[model samples]
Target: MTAAAAATADGAAAAARARTAGGGAGPAGAAAAAAASADDDPFLAVAVPPLPRQLSAKVQHAIISADSQLSERLSEQLGLPRPLILELMRFGAVHYCPVMPKAGPNTPMTPEQLAAASAARAGAMARWGPAPKLQVPRRAMEDAPATAGGYARVHLQPKRFPAAHTTDWRRRVLHQGPDCVVVDKPPGVQVSPTVDNVLESVPACTAAALGLPLDSLAGLHRLDAGTSGVVVLGRGGLAFARWWCGLLEARSGGGGSGGGGSSKSGGKSGGGSESGGGSESGGGSESGGRSGGRGPKAGNEAATARAAEAARAVEAAAEAAAATGGAPLRKVYRAATLSPPPLGRMVHHALVGTRRPGEPAHTLMLAVPVEGSAYCELEVVQVKPIALTGAAAEEFGPSAFESDIRLVTGRTHQIRAQLAASGCIVIGDLLYEAVSARAAHEAAAGERAAHEAAASGRGGGGGGADAAASSAAAGDGGGGTAGGEAGAAAAAAASAEAATAAAEAKCGFAVGSAATAWSRAAQADPLRAIGLQAHRLAVYDPERRLGDGAPAAADLGPGWVEFEAGVPWWRA
Candidate 1:
């Protein structure tokens, strides 16, 4: 038979096999038959072209040279799949065709045809388009600063801070950690200079101190200028948010102890002593057996040694806490007030009726009256009663006194408002009623002097000055608190009381004489996720000499109010 007849016969046989393997009749079967008929080479028909190397050396070089955007641009230009491009970059391969699984064996391509198709596809995609202008990734890796173990210590110079500031603020190590920092901000210094009149605003101070870039440090918390306290500084953005949330949650009893958002700030900086001996057992079976075997004296001696060691450890821990301001940091303030005894009592009582929502019902307060009303020690402030009359009486009752109160709560108009609300307004407080009395006194005196001087013009000029002086004196009670804003006193007291009350209320308590029930809840519940409540805080005005014997306790009238640090038990 001729070559054409031979080819036709071969194709027909392959078609029959293809039809049988591809199930009866349809597009798949027809295509398979066509494929089978296409290959009928007499000899040397098995060998096919090698796989095409599409992405040429030039193409690869172009990709590498194009800025960082080359990969992205190339993918878009070629319409090639990302996986394929990634595969090429990773494996240095141009094309990938999945190997077909063999079932009953009606394959579309023989080994020879398979080889040819793979080569042709690879070559087509290679040199596809003008390589896209590579776009660079936005995030650039920065050089690590002077850091170790998530802490970066960078020195800041004073010049970098705000201008027109008194005193040279020195440069120091801005201790930056992953979460927070312990910074030593100078007294009367603003943290962020641009933020007008901020006390100990360390943000600008931090940047200047470290000689780093601006806006590098953010003040996590604030400290009053006169009252120094530690402030937390967050490092990166993510860590900042986490640490902030962690603090809020832990203090509020939602988040577990991430670091230390304890209920009380002044308490010892660690967990309270697990009291009641933990377990009450005097001995166990093992102890009994050991005592019997080793003799009683030997067991007793061992126990004694253990107890001694434990005692030593406790002593050591106490010493460490004292040294580092670690555990149980306590403060006692010397204050002065006018109201005598029971009336003088400045109790930050739980709100009168239903607690104001969102307020910590547990109100903590401490009021220590200074002695002599003139001289005292331990940071005592002198307070004098400013007499009131006329309209002032209608405004702020008839009595009010003024003095600076060292407050813990930074609440709104806490001290002044609380004091006034307690029926003892701070002297010279315009918000209350003292201002009107001073005005009345000045007006009366001015009229009397004017009538006397107008008849003769003698001492007439001096009357105006006298009136001004009296008004100024009345506006500012003699020897009153000068430094710090006046509103702060009232704001501080109210805030401290509010914060404490809110805290107490959160533990479910209402103000009443039922002390035992509230006490039990405090001891047992402990504000849910927090720890034990330490003893109520007390403010004591230490005695100072006035050329007499030991200075008598300042007349604070009656019992000074007490406060407590609501500590939380940490669950490790």
Candidate 2:
């Protein structure tokens, strides 16, 4: 045995003897048992206790006092020493909310409205909607500090991430082609590097396992840290990677000939760009802050613009599908939910999420689902789903049903949000399921606050109402969390609660109580695994027709490649 393992064994044995002398095997005895098992396993490393957190997990909030160098203002504004703040910043624990420039009008404003806004000193807007709080890295502010009176939302917190140490990353590789490597991503480990540490991510670890340079593999698409599924990584040099990214760019609205304005970009990153992103808006302010990129230098701006246009198109498709009850689905998903819609029914609902700067404003979408909608939408078509009874249902405890989702529009959290909107919350979806339920309560609180503020004459217009709605101002998804922005909260109208709830009975499993639910959902840890999985993935020729968008296509890809992951953790 290794010296460290031997020492641990000896200590554990000594503890066991002491416990035996006192009474029976107790806590020490449990430790001893674990140690003994570790020794027996050939692969087991020396048991080490979890390290205690050195910094507070509670997120610190602040605003730039004035126009100053961002690094210089950190100590005074956030109340931390300059050196310590610098250390945390280097470790990727510091972030600032990006000031999303208001989108210019999509259509001409009414003259009456313009005159009223001019007279009242209120800025004219397409819609007074959810201003998603997007957090990008400190470098953005360091490079360009805000001007005086600009909303500078600064966030400081310690990033504590669990190490994803696997000796056999090669086993996780699903397809290793000449140009790309597809892998079945595990939950908890990030697809990209977190802000604080880069070595613990899937791409880095996988490259290390394959005896390749750390920068050799770059993710083409990223799954959430909590989500387990298919992840495609670009392999080899810059030329092939560029070609692959360029090829994927042709994909849009499910077709091959590539009509004008139908091309979509995957927002491919190169040159190891350390632009931290996470959360719903997918920017620098990740739930677990992250950054870094791979491959040769290439401008991400064009790709980003294409992605924005694609997002707008998806929003349109989703809204139209919801209104028409169905559309030609492109992605198929099978997930376990608390309540499943009727079998063979083209169950449809619009999914919404706010946008940040550089992102296509939710306001740009031509068709909107909910009233004053300031976000995206998605579609789900006919499905053959069944009850997850027997062991699967038992795993769910109270009740669980299986649903087949064929999405005409695929966006982040599309399935989860649509399911929740249909009153079928996905099992263990930490964010949307609970957030929707909690919205009911938050909107109620905001409405009461607005009434009280208006009655008491504490403020004029939406002054008191906006402040009271700080809680609901929280945008959707992990990245669009409630924290970060102080006094920058957008007023989440009461209608959001109704729209999200769809008047379905609240699932006690998600938010039985508001306080407990807040801790679990709104502030959910990024490392916690959810009950969702990309169980199967099949990409077909853009022109192929399928019955109800089933992904068991005869053509998986250009070469007809297909992939299926292992059983879901919950099912297993």
Can you give the TM-score per candidate against the true fold? 0.23, 0.48
RMSD of 2: 18.2
- The residue-by-residue lDDT of candidate 1 on 1-572, one tens digit each, is 34643454345335433423535455565344334422231111110110111111212111121223322433454544333233222211221111111112454666775454444323322433222221211111111111111111111101111121332334333234433343544333332221111112454445455564333454433322211223334443432323233222222233111111111111111111111101000000010000111123555886565445434433443443344333212222211224621223243432211123432122121233333111111211345455445543544455544332332322222343345344443332322222122223334445444433332332233334443443343343323332221233334344545654553453344333343433343233211211111112221212110112211233322222223222111111
For candidate 2, the 10 contiguous residues with the lowest summed lDDT are 281-290
lDDT tens digits, residue span 10-110, model 2: 55434433432323344664354344432233111111111222222344444444556555576677655444443333334456543323324662447
lDDT values for all models: 0.28, 0.43
Tell me the spans in candidate 1 whose CA falls farther than 4 Å from its real position.
1-164, 171-179, 184-200, 223-229, 252-410, 413-572
Point out where model 2 deviates above 4 Å. 1-163, 166-168, 243-249, 253-331, 342-395, 442-520, 540-558
